[model samples]
Target: MKSKGFGKKALDLLFPPRCQGCGKLIDRDDGLCGACLAKYGDEQRESCPVCGRTARECSCGAAALGSSFIGNRRYCAMTFYNEYNADSERITEKLIFRLKRKNSSSLTDFFAREAAAEIMRLMQLSEERPEEWIITWPPRTPRAVLEYGYDQSEAVARRISYYTGIPWKKMLVRTGGREQKGLGAEEREANVSTLALLRRKEADRKRFILFDDVITTGATVREAADLLYGAGAEAVFPVCIAKTLLKEKTDDEGVFV
Candidate 1:
């Protein structure tokens, strides 16, 4: 009541900003504009040279299915982390925040559309028979899900179904283990720390592709593969929308799952 009107006016003026993805004006949302949806209409569709995964550049050397002694198959990524735009990266970062803080399941639609677009493209590129394949993502522990309200990764997997014409199996359960952070590549690469397990009645011979928005240490997928194989998935491989390059980076992050 003392001087509320002037301060409120000044605060509004100072906070006025445009959406990062598109130049549109908005009352609240940032990072992405309303029309900044990802379109793969002109993206490259060639298979990768080094690993047979799909990509224009063949920089991959990750272990293949038979080589892993576990991983079922390998596939291509629609984009490298390098291709991520500033606005998109911000949105991605926001998703991590929303998951970590708000823990809202509603954000799935916002994050999954971007991921789904990329996965749909991957399925489109495969020469394998076109039938519905099982879908999955790393599951969060019951404690984490309850603490955060929902599993963002699972929410992401659910969103992917509509675009990929696949079904997600709710066959995995988390053990509510410790989080992986500040872990090195070597340790991460050899991680035996898995926090999830498959349901008893779920089919073991089911074909499925695991999903993750990010794949930094490779440990997350590596650990998940063990549980999945044990569950009886005939084969299971990962399908990330973006990949990290081997080149020294400037830390300018980009679009994410």
Candidate 2:
């Protein structure tokens, strides 16, 4: 029998691995090359989206999140993202696009690790135990799931569960809807009818951490939280790999919905 290492070496020679961000050949098939990896997490938050203060100094309360549907709970994200920026300038956007186009365990795991740390920090500050919270995600549209053969958010949630030791459950379902990629804020808000509760009774007074790949207009999460609240969830704290930043809005203007 051939050694697995030998087989891998042969495969690499046959099909060179290219960086997902820049198409540069890399030593391994790890989604991104050294340069792209170094560039990751380098984008400064600049200021807290909830408050106008510098990110490192801001101490806004949960109610400042500006989402009445979440019971004034806080949301966490690893980085800020802007869909309008060219992927060349925003490697995170490229990673997100790649993840949506195809599932990559390494990529998803990377995102989950960061998100897990942030979630833990928030829970610790709030004196909430991990076991008290359930990990869940706003399921992707059925059409996207069928096209990609997986829900990227679900993949991230499962990995986060593994990192944080929190149990993950499928609590929401998306029947069918047009993809929200290019839709405007109002269009996205009006598109919430597609989502429905999957485990309605299971949500009773349960504290949930909703995970997702990226948060754009916040429409999807708002709708998801609404469903959970209606299902009797005690609270829903959303966590994501990236949060969309509105460049036109100043820090004092509140970037999130």
Candidate 3:
């Protein structure tokens, strides 16, 4: 019989791998080339330790509000998508656009691995690593699924589960919601409150980590966490790959702005 390695080599020869970030030819099927990988590394390292904002911005307020609805709940994210910083914003937009539009599985896998590592690190810092933590994600609206042909958040969550050795299940169903883009914080919160319903059977799990792609006003995750808490989840930790920085309003004086 032919060896498995021989089959793999034949496939590689037929279809050489390309970098997920730039579509450049590469040796492997599952990651960016050195330059693209370095970009991610630099962003991760430069992001704020507290709220994941880039070095000059402070947006911990939004991060703080992530768990406001659920007392004592923790929230964490990988990096910031700051609109004020053109470069940071552009990179974030590109990453998300590629994931949602192209459905780049290798890119998704790369992000999932990073997120899983962060989740583990956070759990370790808390000193309460549960033996079996349930991994779940906020479901996209059915309309979005229809438009995108797949759910990006779910895709990332499943990959994270695979990387972390944790099981992932669909624990929430999005009933309805208008698109959250361009909405103010208050409107965003109200909109998401009616967006999701928990799956009772799955909700019985003790601990859950709910992840999403980007956290803007944090309304979506907050509402999702509330639903999970209501469904009897002992704890719900919100995780995301990128966070949108809360833009500060300032007057002409620029004092206390």
lDDT score of residue 242 within candidate 2: 72
Worst 10 residues of 3 by lDDT: 248-257
lDDT of 1 at 41: 20
Quote the positional error of residue 174 for candidate 2 in Å: 1.2
Clashing pairs in 2: none
State each model's CA lDDT, in order: 0.54, 0.73, 0.69
Question: Candidate 2: global Cα-lDDT?
Answer: 0.73
lDDT: which candidate is best? Answer: 2
lDDT at 42, model 3: 79
What are the clash counts of all predictions, listed in order? 3, 0, 0
- Give the lowest summed-lDDT range of ten residues in model 2: 63-72
Which residue segments of model 3 deviate by more than 4 Å?
Answer: 1-8, 47-59, 62-73, 83-89, 177-194, 249-257
TM-score of each: 0.58, 0.75, 0.76
| Predicted candidate 2 versus true structure: per-residue lDDT over 1-257, tens digit per residue | 28766686687798787786788998877667888877874654456554554422342432333342222246766666767344547788778888788676667776787788877777676677899889999888775775789989999899899999999999998775666788999987776547889989999989889887787777788789889989999878877777765444434334454
Give the candidates in order of lDDT, highest first. 2, 3, 1
Name model 1 segments beyond 4 Å from true: 1-31, 34-61, 64-73, 76-107, 141-143, 176-193, 248-257
Top TM-score model: 3
